[model samples]
Target: MEFAERHDLLNKTFTPRSPVNQRQLFSGRIDQLAKVQRAVESPGTHAVLYGERGVGKTSLANVAEQIAPIWNSETIALKVTCNSNDTYSTIWRRAFSKITFSEKSQSVGFLSETSINTRSFAETLPQELTSDDVENALQRLKKHARLFIIFDEFDRVFQASSTLTLPFSDTIKSLSDNNYDITVLVVGVADFIGDLIAQHESIERAIVQIPMPRMSSVEIGQIIDTGAARLEMAIENPARQQIVKLSQGLPYITHLIALHSFQEAITNNDANVNKGHVSIGIQTALDEWQASIKTDYVKATTSVQKKNIFREVLLACALAEVDEIGYFAAADVRSPLREVTGQSYDIPNFARHLKEFSSENRGKIIERTGQAKRLRYRFNNPLMRTYVIIRGVAEGMIPLEKIR
Candidate 1:
């Protein structure tokens, strides 16, 4: 029975995790997947992945591990994230744990090389291991088998780069040049790693590199169908187009918006997802984007990015309503953004963001009709713009619509 018919059935929304249900919502990433598969199968395949945040970099890696078994090789994938506390010792210990985790290790033959003499490591481990201790343990572990250690978000260790407790570059190099049975994969997007590489060329050579690509509209539709399928909710045709356009063909955004829309509809006791719920979800997604910008975007901490992103998107969403406005361009609404932020950004930057969701990029502005190109720069997430407009009005940054 349809959700509308079964009033007794409970409603639930999906949650975001490391690897989103790609099979369900995973869209056009076959080429990307094949590239990653090749990396995992190759020995000592060290790679650096770069993409807009939420572009499924982590999911790709997770998927890489899942498909590793298909290839004829003993693949043990250990995924550990790097952060502020990732000292040399912290890295090795976490690397050790990830490497040893039964979920990954059991599939492949990963055993400590040295005598199971955990006496010292055990004695000192409960307390955080300093950089020195980890380096020592790593040297000891070197004797055993070839290990593939993946450090996700490796750029989070920006501050510690100058004072690295262990010679990270040298270690990876020694293992690689020596062709030790060890490999390293460092993944991040914070840009610090790329900058760090310029400063230290040798470390750059030790690792292989791979950058994840964005999703296309067809792929995004697949994600929407997958997400809706899970809820037993089939999206109306128009809603799918709105999602694809609003999400800018991003898998993560697709999943996020779809999940939020489903949640909104279920929460409000709606029978099926319609434009109303999608509107609400767009707002929620905007709020999340605001929170994300505020989290580490210290430069424009006062919701600077939020303000602009929201302003342009909000205007477009409002503009999208008029029937003649079948296709609205962002350039059609730049004035609103300037008014909202009280300052101008690089028009090129703003224009680029029309396609790229990141604060640094501009949203793609498209003309709905006519040979004359419609001009506009809207945000990738309509919700992001909505959140900004609401907050701006709340902060007295932008006046109410009636006043505007």
Candidate 2:
């Protein structure tokens, strides 16, 4: 392929910094997509999609919105992202503004179909909004038309005001009770459903709780294979396995590493991407990571003494086994620590380091959960965990041969 053509193909195939907007570019998540489709198709049913960061929650929501029209010709899908400044009234107004309602004039003797009027749903809403007001306005819409409203980044609204979710709960309950043709999908970064929606008990029976875990190795490989097929590129088995294992089940890491590996092969005029290309790709990924992540790593590992174990402990924490929500206990770190240092270790040896990582003094890189007797830890940002592992492998603390 020509130089410019390969560059274009790379750009079209990989999206590390953006969510998957087109259905053709999306991969995996078949079961999650089915649940979302079912929610939209069933009257009086809604959905809440909650998961850890970088797990592709927004991408799923985007694809769900795009496919709604295919399921029903009269489906009107609308979406709005919530920010710290958004209120219940402002959010509804923003969503309603995207809806354009068309009205036809009555036909007369000589002026048949004189004109048509078009207006946004926002114009119909009163200045101050409430659950009853939203329900009444929605009820006025054509009975045959189905409405799908997706509120992305809903955690931002919850962070701004815990009470804000009550209005939404009430609105959903009202709509479900009346069997309206409206479906609401809430997408956010959260470990649990309650973290994103307060007063959810009232609407518990009305919505489906879809928790998006990290992608499986098979699913992550599908992303690489799909993109590589689009570019007519071949990836060696070792390189492919390295990317999948290092990705640690996060799609963002897969895209980042795969994009650079493909670029490395193209620059070398090679027909296939190999292990060497993956090495260069890993280095490039580390170099291009956000400054904030780098800073957080330094803060967590820096020490005044030359023999300090902060760096080793933090790396062990990265390699530690985590549960579905990403929480890992101190005991989980002991095994990885021993493997890295070839020395016997215990919780007491690194417990203080773990505490410091969770403190503001160490940039709070890891968050502590549970009581003192049964404390568990997880990285404050899921992406940070991936960064730690990659950095470890690059720096020789984690041997590449032992990654999997």
Candidate 3:
């Protein structure tokens, strides 16, 4: 590859954590993006986007903020990220301060000539406030421009103060019902809406809930192709398939794997990434992610027997049907366990391990649902699944052919 080509590709090809800005670079989220646009355009409609960590919830929020205005010319999107210490008053204070209002006119008795004074809602916004105060402030601001306020990491509000949930929920419902020109978009990491906010029946119809799921195989492929195209590089079918399969539906993993593969090929003075480059890329990603995965793995497996059992369980989960990447049933894991361990263990035996893995104070590696006969489970962290896949292959627990 030429120096200019390599430099441009390296600059444009990889972004593991930050949100993608260019529309063509963003991939596989057409539906969610459309929902956000619709909610922004329609009167009295707000949205809440919830999903697992690293599933691109924040990225979608960022992209929506940029494009929502395309559907409505008056829309103005503003976003604020919350921390564990954020409260309703503090968060709203920050939001109001960020709004850039046109300067208000002021006059002096002697010099009645045109004079201007800058002002913002936050200047007079009370420290001790209620939902009504926020609604009133938003109502006044909406006359100038339609608002799209995004509360990224919104779960922090409730985590900091559970009492704020009802107030926040009430404020959202009131703002929506009153037809204020402002639409609030809440983004968080959770399995369900109720987990993030208070379970209020009144909120059921007040907000448009968009649950962001893991990317599909086709979507992951788009990301690979889009990045490779930008870099003026090519990824062989085997290499592309390897990255997507091991990504486990998370876009971050895809970026990490692809970045490593790109760097590996560049080092070798090659433009095409083959399975060999992918294999090395996997090892590199595994090394970079080793510390965190080992910490979680050690926490998940305390006993020798549990450790042995978990190795088999993770390999089985990785080997599950492509459709069932993060989630798999115990029955799905049984066949692989028998293959790996050559020992027949009943569901009852695995049940204890699952319970421990799902416990809050313990492993917290997985979450399970359903009854005894139809139990299902999913990795709480997609990185854990990626770690499992890499470990399985490195340790010879999983065959290379299986992943390819």
Candidate 4:
């Protein structure tokens, strides 16, 4: 194959660092897509899509937004990406400005009727806005089309505001209460509504909560099939299974492994990927992702004075059996810690590290789950879990024979 052709195929087929392109080949999440469509069609039924970072929440939202216009011509999909410093007013104003209301010109005569083209209002958003201001803007577009506002990366708002910003919830409540021709679709990293915002009990009734979990092995296989079809290549069953096993239900990890595997195949001028290609792919993925993984580790462990404890704590979690989504409690890590370090340590001893790991913008590598008495923690980035596994073995922190 020519170099440019291979390069183009690689760029289009593998998207680890960015969200899947709207026109690109995508797979799985059929149920989530249907839920979004149903919520969009039902009047006054907004949606809240919450999940881990790389479980394809954004991809589902993006695909839904793209498909909504085709399903309903009147649907106007507006995406507002939140940053750390953005407030409710700032975010809403940016979304409001994208709205353009249109109408068909009405005329009396045949000549006038012939000239009846669609006309739209110019966007004019207020610099300083309030909940009332946003509601009023939605009201003006009532006669035109339905608005589907998608707030992606919404967790950043909470990261910026410890309380999750009450005004934002109030705006949503007010909009729902008034029965505006709008469906606010919130996409974020969270286990429940309370994690995203506070004092918004009123809006809960109007929302359709959809919690996205890890993709099934079958669904993940579809991703491999889709990518293989796109590249006009084949992934051998063993190689495909390796990718799926290592990915742990995260699409980003799948993409990373698939990308390198495909590259390995291309370099060998082979159309089929085997276990050897997959093994090399895994090593390549780890090498490429190590710098960022180390950065997060360094940042997360800086607070611990004893670097050895921090390393052992992280290694323990990585070694623990974390179900499919990489969730492991302190108890789950205890045995692994002792095995790796040849020293005994209790949960309470490293409880501080757990807190730091779950803290936002501090470590922010792991998040707490389950009830109060039985709290379990999962790595916020699935790739980090995979990284820790590889790095531990490479650094001699873990016995190479122990890796599964």
Candidate 5:
């Protein structure tokens, strides 16, 4: 391939900043996709896709919307993203606007002619909206086509007003009770479905909860392989394994590092990507990390004492083992802390550091959950966890060989 062609292929294959809207570019989450397919195929059933940040919830939702019509030829999929200022009525208005409907009219003249007009579904919605209003509009539209409405970033609306979810809950219940042919998919960042939607027993059975976990090593490798194959490039085993370890199970990290690694190989005029390229990729990924994340890391690790342990402690926290939801107990940090610091450590040694990390004074990089002795901690942003680990390797605190 020519130089420009390779660069173009690189751009098209790796998209760290954007969600994968095309099914061909998306990887993993087969089970999540299956659950979504089932929900879309079944009437009066909706789905909620929730997970920690950077787990590709939006990408899954996007691909789901694209493929839903394939699963049912009559299905019409529409999506609307939520913002902090969005309310229940505004959200539905945005969703409905994506749908275009047609109207036919016949002339009364001798040479009678038929005229077709197209308009947005939003035109049918009333100014003062209620769950009944939404249900009624959807019910009317169902006569022509089955609807699949995706409410992406739903957590933003919920965070703006927890009460806003009440109307959505009411709408879901109404639709299910009436056996409407419409499905609603709510996508957002949350450990539990309740974090994104209002808890209502009436709509409990009407919705399917699809929790998206981080990609596994094998799944992450598919992303690397698929992208490399598209460009007709080869990524050696060691380089592929390094990217997976550095990614720490997040797809976003994989893309970021892989994009740079491919670029590095191309610059060196080598079609094969190796560990040296991956090392450069890691450096570039950290250097180009978002300002907010860098700021938070500095805040979480900065200290006044000469013998500061904040940085080491934070790195230990990053290397700590986390459960399915990303929560880890204080005990989990001890082993990693000992490894990072080359010293024996216990809960009391860095208890204050954990408390400070969860406080606003330290940017609240890690969030504290549970209570008393049973408390667990997790990074407020999952990407921050990956960032911390990469920083460790970059600073020699963590050797590349020790990644796995």
Candidate 6:
């Protein structure tokens, strides 16, 4: 059997309810999915769906149509991924491409088609469209069903270009405020967009954020059972136990683990996927994690030495396996870092690196308290720290005092 035929994991080839521009696998997050459905169906409002990577944020955007059939059976949703490369022209073209209209968009009616050009649109979009022959094209759109858009990977687009702020704030922000019945949903990592929205008047007025919560274990079990039944194979007890222990109810990791175990099982010619396969998958996962951290660390960062400097302070975070909420502190980290680096760092440089490392890790490092004095450092992902510690990429989060 081919890999697709034999590998029965949900991530491998799970079926979505509808035909979409991108492939989507809906495994869990019934609750979060339901919330997005409510927001989309509510009408007269816009929302931002933000979350960590590989946590089904984009998939949710793609499969969000699943809820449409329930509400009106005619609700139309168009999803777009925005990155640094996306511009006024690109976004307009994309909007024209994804959204349908009562009449063909290409047939000119009023505004000059030249004004629809990227550079022109960059300066004056709908305003230019109003003056150009393309106004007829846009009016044709109003004749169609109400348009809804979801922008996925929004961070990549914002981070990719520096000059894009004006175009972005104008195109997307304006789309949200135009007083049209169209609803816009933007989905991606939450890091900078929150502040970006706060800065823009139109953005602040038009947008409402609806964050996706982390996965829960009960829902995870349902996904596990669903994936297994679809595969026509049973998960061995040992594998099940190991997955539950390691996954911590995280959906992406859960699917990745399940897929890896299934592949290992098929390779071994075993009908049942067991802990041995899970153990191998776990090790492979850690190795991949180490490599990924190294790559991103190097890209977003300059040197491992620089990364290591901060590591000493975050040593307490590197070992924390499960920080559900809250964080550890830079104060607790300073002395240990000095101990590791074999040198003393003054408070100023020390504070800079501490904040820098926290910025580097961001949500991965949980905040223990809202106040600086009360704040503590916590790993955003418990398992990622565990992976780093096992690979010797980071020092233990457990203070040395506890080793005694």
TM-score of candidate 4 against the unseen true structure: 0.80
Model 4 CA lDDT for position 275: 82
Query: Stretches of candidate 6 above 4 Å error?
Result: 1-4, 8-11, 14-25, 66-70, 100-140, 162-178, 199-206, 288-290, 294-315, 319-327, 331-386, 389-404
| CA shift of 265, model 6, Å | 1.6
Location of the lowest summed lDDT over 10 successive residues in candidate 5: 190-199
Per-prediction TM-score: 0.61, 0.94, 0.86, 0.80, 0.95, 0.66
User: How many clashes (backbone atoms < 3 Å, residues ≥3 apart in a chain or on different chains) does model 3 have?
Assistant: 0
The parts of candidate 4 lying over 4 Å away from their true place are 1-3, 101-122, 162-164, 195-197, 298-313, 319-327, 334-382, 390-404
Report the lDDT tens digits of candidate 1 across residue range 1-404.
46454333222223343455334344567886666555555554456676655667777666655555555355555668788867765666766665441121233346634323223333445456654555466566656544556677776686655555236655655555555545566666635555546645775665556666557778778777765666666777776776776554346567666767777777776657887787777667656764543332232222355445634434434333222213355554455556655566544645544444334422231222333355433333333433344445435665444222
* Greater-lDDT candidate between 4 and 6: 4
Each model's lDDT comes to 0.55, 0.87, 0.78, 0.78, 0.88, 0.55
- Residue pairs that clash (backbone atoms under 3 angstroms), model 2: none
lDDT of 3 by residue, 1-404 (tens): 58666866675667775666667788989999889888887778888898777778887887887886787888788889998888888888888888765675657788677756667668878887778889888878888899999999888776768777877888877876777767889998663368434556666676888888988999999999998887778999988988888886788888888888888888888889899998898888777874767888767765655345766765666565533235688777677667666788777777677777888655678878788777788877777877787778777776756663
Which residue pairs overlap in candidate 3's backbone? none
Cα lDDT of model 5 overall? 0.88
Provide the lowest-lDDT 10-residue window in model 4: 114-123
lDDT by residue (87-122, candidate 5, tens digit) is 888998888889887899999989999999999988
The C-alpha local distance difference test score for the whole of candidate 6 amounts to: 0.55
Candidate 1: C-alpha lDDT: 0.55
Candidate 2 accuracy as TM-score: 0.94
Error of 4 at 379 (Å): 3.3
TM-score, candidate 6, is 0.66
lDDT of 4: 0.78
Model 6, residue 335: distance off in Å is 15
Model 4, residue pairs in steric clash? none
Candidate 3 TM-score, C-alpha based:
0.86
Please report the candidate that would top TM-score against the real structure: 5
Candidate 2 per-residue C-alpha lDDT over 319-358 given as tens digits, one digit per residue, 9 for 90 to 100:
9998877899999999999978888888999999999999
